[model samples]
Target chain A: MKYKDYYEILGVPRDADDDAIKKAYRKLAHKYHPDVSKDPAGEEKFKEIAEAYATLKDADKRAAYDRLGSHSPGQDFQPPPDWGTQYGEQDLRFEDIDLSDLLAGLAGGRQRGAGRRGTMAMPGEDYEVTARISLEDAYAGTLVDLNLSVPEYDANGRLHRVPRVFKARIPKGATHGQRLRLRGKGGKGFHGGRDGDLYLNIELVPHALFRPSGHDLYLDLPLAPWEAALGATVAVPTLAGTVHLKVPAGTAAGSKLRLSGRGLPTPHGKPGDLYAIAQIAVPPKLSEAERELFQKLAAGSTFDPRSHFNSEVKHGD
Target chain B: MATEPVEPAWLNDDARVSLDELAALSGLTDAALRELVDYGVLHPVDAAEAQWTFSARWVVVARTACRLRNDFELDLNALALTLSFLDRIRDLEAQLRSANAQLPRRHY
Candidate 1:
């Protein structure tokens, strides 16, 4: 079995008092606990921290661990043959067990002969998975197969992760940051306890062409200067398909053209609107003829875009 | 055998739960949930009803609060304040993310 230095995991000295170990555990627990932490690896980190503290906090378990002598973290080592007998646990084969397993068994040994009842009805643990989907999927309901390695005890009472696949049907209209609870979808309950739930926190991938705000979709529509100046019917893409949008003459850049009830479809109410924000596109390299025409239009035009920039407050004409 | 496909209910801002169900789901007593309602930590859909009915989402909130309370050994009085602050933080983070999403994801 590979040795895991409980002291190193908690960043404490081997001779550190219980108070120091507790302080370290509490501090790390507050930072990395799964429910409160936002860090991606917080749960894993908290598990290690919790396991380390679980051993070092107990007097008997800590002493048993101390007797194993020091070895580098993860170094392959086997306990002395007499080690099991010294701890009154001769049946446990150290080679097949983790350091955590050894320590945890010792903890259970300490609590033995205390009227330990059979398994109680404890609820299963809740599972939270962030499911990232596209804007198109949110428009239409889709199914996702979640392959999760769930921890469970083997026939020999050794902890192992059993692979399980669950098909989750995400309903339509799931927006970004939305949380959907799948009833009884988490870890199985112990004995006759109530099964836990699985929470799918929806994360919508940033769409290439569209930006979603709540149910509404926004996209920048590129329009040639002439098209903006002279009204035209242009085809715009929606989640379903393309639709013709009439851009009014004299439409300013950054102004929105609303496509009613074309955004996302919701079950509770009418669909949201799609907004096309106008953005005027100009040719980067102009031909000689185009340059001459542009120069003529600029020379003839009386529109002053910077007229308001000259005054602190504009006067109403 | 095929893994049974489970269809999840799309959660909305609506959906009511009575006090008894909320208490059972949250792993909290009815009186404690009522106390939370008094503190404005939770809002009931029907406050005047003999058994208050809350939005179903509050079950998650109350359970989260319970977890925090047990994990940190926080007192009941302090649980409401902590939950409110956490909710605000989550809201602010979500607001920031959506506001940032308003910009184009990829730039040419």
Candidate 2:
């Protein structure tokens, strides 16, 4: 029940003109706009600015707010008892704004519907929720169960959030950051108005074995030193199942081999390819005989891995 | 008794939302929407204002425009320009994300 100072929040003098107020608000709005701003507090700041602008922009609301003299932001002071009688409730219609007790008291505790008699009809506000699914589930369609707490207005016109559970089918090829809209599944409408739509923002959970890029999938394929040096057919794991991948002879570490049409399937266009990246693994320990064979091979071999390094270093200098 | 499972109604990008629905969802008055139309902010399905229908994505645009108008006291034309710029910025950011996602992973 804090008394918010609208003028102070907008950084404008109490006696500032409409044009000056508008200019200040615009500057702050641009700075704190949630879409454009990188600030983590931008959304909250934008809401505060919007609330301040909402009250100060209208002359009647400004006059009413100005009457409560010298009250600072966050310093709680109740409105005078005669406040409701003077405003007549009908003049105040702060649409969709949930005000504090002090501000709500000025409007006679009614947020909407000032002079209306019968049941007011207004469409419900749209609701958005994030839905996180596994990359595999996104690759292959799956039914997901979601538990959501939805706000409902009781008979006494008080709002309460009630939990509801439902199941939704995640269509195959659903990408990260995609939005799935469900019509008429949002907040309940007031009176006989239509309910709002529900939007589900999709987020793909990172897979342990696969990393998705666009529609394609990438996985690290581990190979022994001999297998990497000489070609071998290795079983690679895909979303569907394991398939044999042919690793060409002399495959170097970090080499990417593409397996066409083995990745996630899209609704339209061709399915994406899966890439197997070569990773060479060596034995940590060797027996005496193995060590002796390796030493003999090293003595006989004339291969120099760092032959180009000295030449490159000389050229750089 | 077990409750029936909820079946989601998937709406694509091409889905059209009615004017009344857009007005209710965006909290924008009909007059303000008309002004936005005059400024070429919204492209309706039809030419006539009374029978105007907006794309589903325009719902978000209209809501952003309403907030901008309320906070900044911007006229319809300025609001339209701002919304256009915002849209362009969003498109560029999405493109950047896609490009970054395609970059090869470096293993050190």
Candidate 3:
């Protein structure tokens, strides 16, 4: 097994006082603690820090660690003969235990499968991962697959990182930034400790036609000028199917038309409403007849769209 | 290959836990957990005299508290203050994420 230097992990000198070890531990813990840390590798670093602190803080464990002799970090070596007898762990091979478990023995927690004289029972690690589902999938329930490496004890009682694939369901009506916690879905527990949870952070992929806010959906409803002037039944697209929306007569631009219960589905409640913002779709190049008709209407009409602009308020030239 | 089935119940509000389960899972003592509730660091689903049940989400929060307590040797007051700040930071981060999603796509 590889040799780990606890003092080096905690960044303290060999003869450093107890208080110095503690202060160093606190600083590193604050920086790497999973709750406050934004670092991607924070959890693993924090665990190393905790294990180091656990061994060095106690006098007996520190003496045992010192007795293991000074070696370069990760150098492969075995404990001395007397060392095995002292902890009653003679039968287990070096491959069967971790350096953390060896020192955790001095800290007094039972390591799993180490028989009577074992180390600590630490809880499993919680994993947080992001799952990006398309807006269409968000409307209907969908499946997501995540790949993660979790710790596990082999048949010989050695810990190894096992790659695993987890499949989870993102329920309908799931919105961006929602956190879903799955119990016992994370890393395997150490010893007899409970398995940790898996947290899924949901992110909706951008859709070409729809904009989602929570469960609600927004889309631009383009209407021809004549269609806005005269009421018309227009085809509208929704997740389930296409439905006709009635455009009220004389509908103005920027009016939000509601399609009740036509948005994303919720797990347990009513689905959100969809809003279609009205946009006047004028023909970029009008035909000769169309231009003449528009010209005639302009000549016959006395309506002014700029009537709201008061005389005192300056208007752009 | 057959697809793995998911237990969606874990994500539901009904996935509540007792005080003992929370303590064992979080590596915090029963007394320490109560200190969290007393200081408003946590809000249990049911805070009755007969028993206190916390939402499953609190398990992670309690575990975070336990690690900070042991590593920093912090008293209850200090732990509570730090946790509250972390909570606010998490909320703000979530808000930022959603708000960013709504912004127009940047053309580069």
Candidate 4:
């Protein structure tokens, strides 16, 4: 097996004090912590740091590791003849440890195996993963296909990830950040223990036209200048279908028109409302006749759009 | 080859989880979980420690707490406080997201 330099991994000297080792670990831990870090390799780096700290922090493990000699990292080596016997007698067991293959072979040999230590039942580890779905899928239930790489143990008790594929149903009203647990779908158990559960964290993908806020939906409704000036019934799109929205006379931009119970459907209670926000749009280029008509209307009109700004400026002066 | 269609079992807030199951899922020892309870980090279903039952959502809570504890080497009390703060941050972030979703999209 390839040898691992725990000291090198932690960026500490071999003879460093406990305080120094801890300081180095804490700094690295903060930098590589998966929850806080945005780095793509943060999880893997954190795992490596944790493994290094776990071995180096313990005096016995550090001594045992040091006794293996001055081999460089990735060097091919084996534990001394009496190494296992010495550590085995101490009843040291590594629990919930995701170790490298070399360390797993050494630490997990007799203690982790089932038959050699008699039949023992250990519940398999639970797995958590995020599943992203569209807003439409969240509104109306849909089937989603998922390909998972699940870790499994071989006949020789080695860990390897095997590809698993299945289709799951995303229930209606499944909100963002909701966790759906699948029973007995995680890692396989040992010695007849029950398999662990899998937790699917729901993430709703953003929609192009609709913005979802809890159960409510919002849509930007573009209106012509004449449509805003005069009351008009226009078609608005909802998740279910298109419906006609009545804009009141002299409707201004940024006005929100609420359509009751037109948003996402809920299992219980009142369904949410959809809001169509008005945005008055003008033609980019007008023809000669249209320009002449606009010019005549502008010459006749006395409406001041910046009256509020003028009032505020006068009051300030 | 055809893949199997799996029906997912959704766990609600009311779903019960045993102490051992919680420990296995969270990677925290039973003693650490008890300490968490003492520190007000976890609220079990019943008062008795022996037959204590937790909600299935505690699995996520406990796992997150366990990760923070391992990364920071924090004591139980500090860990509990940190977890509470983290929960507040998550809640605020969700609220912000919901509020932002209500705003009209800007097309440049």
Candidate 5:
């Protein structure tokens, strides 16, 4: 029920050229395709990506969508009444030229029909479920038990609750709202056709120590002010465990330490590096003893960090 | 009173035919079994020239490979890679669990 920014979802700028949009969509589609991905929630994400590209890829539809301005697909959606009449009178048919049947693969086994129908067939129903993973479990990748709450209608026509337990694998680099599909896991197929897939959308809870990046891990390493200026050997956390890291001497603030082959491993066995970005922590309050020591140290040093500011200044002749 | 730890279901269960019996029963060629072994998904006890034995675990591994290839539509190389990672994760998890359990709990 949330409004998704199609351009942002496709990793494209709002003013991106049509060629750029197409290129981005194609590359992302190939990567997140359910058939190719081992991600537990890949199919639904593929559908969302397809839906985003479907509207944004067209010129007229993109214009209308842009004008709608931050509304969900069916939220108070009404087109201009005279617009269809104008097109009808102009002898122009908005045939399904823009929407190819290629999207059916993204929606999971939905087939194209023989008729010239304007709208696409109802997509296979998608089911949303949650998967929880520990930071290490997410980094190394592991199978998870997903408790799915499926709604079932009783003979009296009242909806009842039915819970199903499924085991799904969460691949490395999975992000929030990324979808995975289980074949024949959704509602029964219409007309005795194969059932739709069960879509698991990921929602990763916060970890006490580890954070996730795309095939990488992030963690905040608290460093002393002295450690930032005059470096020290520190123990840093990684997906495998904590490892000793060398903070190079004279390292400035915002410097990053790269620990090679210490992050999440890709399916192809290539691993990402752990990045330890430097953050100089300034104490909020200092005791009189500490303040005196700092004042003496400040007086002893003849260093001006902004010394280059005046040197770089250029005056008009 | 402290409660005893529960063992995993896989552990308490009977040592079903080690990968060797599975190979003899499955009638699959040695080449196919080698492929499964190379993927690191199936564990075999011994390897010899035309005399290697596989556990019944290979059947499950083979089925998983089949599902990954036929149903999920992954290529052989990708399927192999996915299974290899899954095995590595499982191994790491077991090690972590053992290490955590072995550490003495410090109660303040």
Candidate 6:
């Protein structure tokens, strides 16, 4: 069997502390993770880091690996004939075991069998939770404290809530349907496996004023009849702030005004536009004085709106 | 420096299409255009039984049909009925446009 050095791969001292090992694993994992890493050897480097982490993450597995001397142990490598009995039949399936099959299973069959530490279980379990943010918060992005209340049994076997607060930095272009993952924060290992990760599903709260239309926002602006007839610049509301919208002279009702770059910034990095459609509002039931003014205006006005109907009837006849 | 506007020879000209051009632009089969005519939404100028011809006005009907199908997820039958209502609205709009052209003169 080839000589595999777990300590050398993790860049840690022979007798490094547990906290130091965990910190090293996180740093190496982030550096080598295929999702974020651009190196040509990213996958291979990630496997090496995971292999080192699997062994060093747990006390018992680390001791067993230390005893084995071969990080990549082969079938030919033999400890004492009665190694299991000597270890008092320690459940190799303990939570800290870093076996490849178990990790692959927990990761939903993405990982292939590679890291083999006897029957030692992998460290950590994976968990899923949701993060709810406002649409505004999602638009601007935010750093928020996510509180997780996990139920566990104490030393006396009494059930209690284990409260944990993690500060998560949401990415700038995080959308409502996207997911974020926190590594090694899930259920504890059985014997000595690494704890799983926590998957965060983001939920965006609905907004009252802003309606999303393919990265663009849409708004219905109610305008007076005169404003629709004679175009007027009106103050309109947008996701960022209020802005004056130019209503072209002779603008009709239902005419849409576009404000470029006022829409949500999509994950693809392109910004959407905001569309404001104008609608004319008519006055309801007039008072006696208001009725007289309209009556006088109608009597004095020579504009007959229905006169075109007379020409159409003559042409049809 | 400000640039002067150019005038075209075809002033007050509207876009027009021959029967073949209409069929090419509309992308509908001959039978489909007949289906639109049968529904009374499209009225093509008829010369003879086999020599019937359509106009570019059918472009609006075809485009509205596409919008109903793709955007609003409406089926062909419902779209045909909606186009009938839209035809009535077009006739009313044409009447209004003609009426706006003639106004009594006023001396100020």
TM-score each candidate: 0.85, 0.68, 0.68, 0.77, 0.42, 0.39
lDDT of 3 by residue, B1-108 (tens): 223747543333436789998897677999988988999988888676569988777876887788778767889899999999988997887677545534434221
Off by over 4 Å in 4: A1-9, A13-21, A38-41, A55-99, A108-118, A266-271, A313-317, B1-3, B11-58
Error of 3 at A300 (Å): 12
Instruction: Give the DockQ (2 decimals) of all models.
Output: 0.52, 0.30, 0.33, 0.46, 0.03, 0.01
lDDT by residue (A1-317, candidate 6, tens digit) is 23457788889987899999888877886677643465859767986887678767767667755665544432334444454454444323323222432223222232322122224554444445567877688678676666765533344322344676766666545544455555555555433655555656676665666655435665667787667767888999876888998887766666667889887776546677877766667667778987887788789979676898987776643
Best-to-worst ranking by DockQ? 1, 4, 3, 2, 5, 6
- Model 1, A1-317: lDDT tens per residue? 88998899899999999999999888988999887898989988988988898888889888889989999999989887777888776566666557776676564533421112325665666777888889999999888878776655555554444678888888887787677788888866665777777778888888888888778888888888888989889999999999999999998887789999998877578888898888888987899999999999999999887887868777687
Tens digits of lDDT, candidate 5, B15-96: 3444444543333345665776776666655655345544434444554455455433466677788767756775675566
Question: Which tens-of-lDDT digit does each residue in A20-72 have in candidate 3?
Answer: 99999989988998767889799889989898998888887888888889899
Docking quality tier of model 3 = acceptable
Candidate 6 regions with alpha-carbon error over 4 angstroms: A1-119, A151-161, A183-195, A250-253, A284-317, B1-108
Q: Which regions of candidate 2 deviate over 4 angstroms?
A: A1-20, A66-77, A90-121, A140-170, A207-209, A222-226, A240-243, A252-255, A265-271, A279-317, B1-5, B11-88, B102-108
For candidate 2, what TM-score does chain B get against the true chain B? Answer: 0.76
**Top-scoring candidate (lDDT):** 1
Residue-level lDDT of model 5, residues A18-42, one tens digit each, is 8898888778766776645667577
Specify the highest-TM-score model's number: 1
Error of 5 at B56 (Å): 31
Error of 2 at A251 (Å): 3.6
Worst 10 residues of 1 chain A by lDDT: A109-118
Which 10 successive residues of model 3 chain A have the least lDDT summed? A109-118
Clashing pairs in 3: A109-A119, A109-A120, A110-A119, A111-A119
Better of 3 and 6 by TM-score: 3
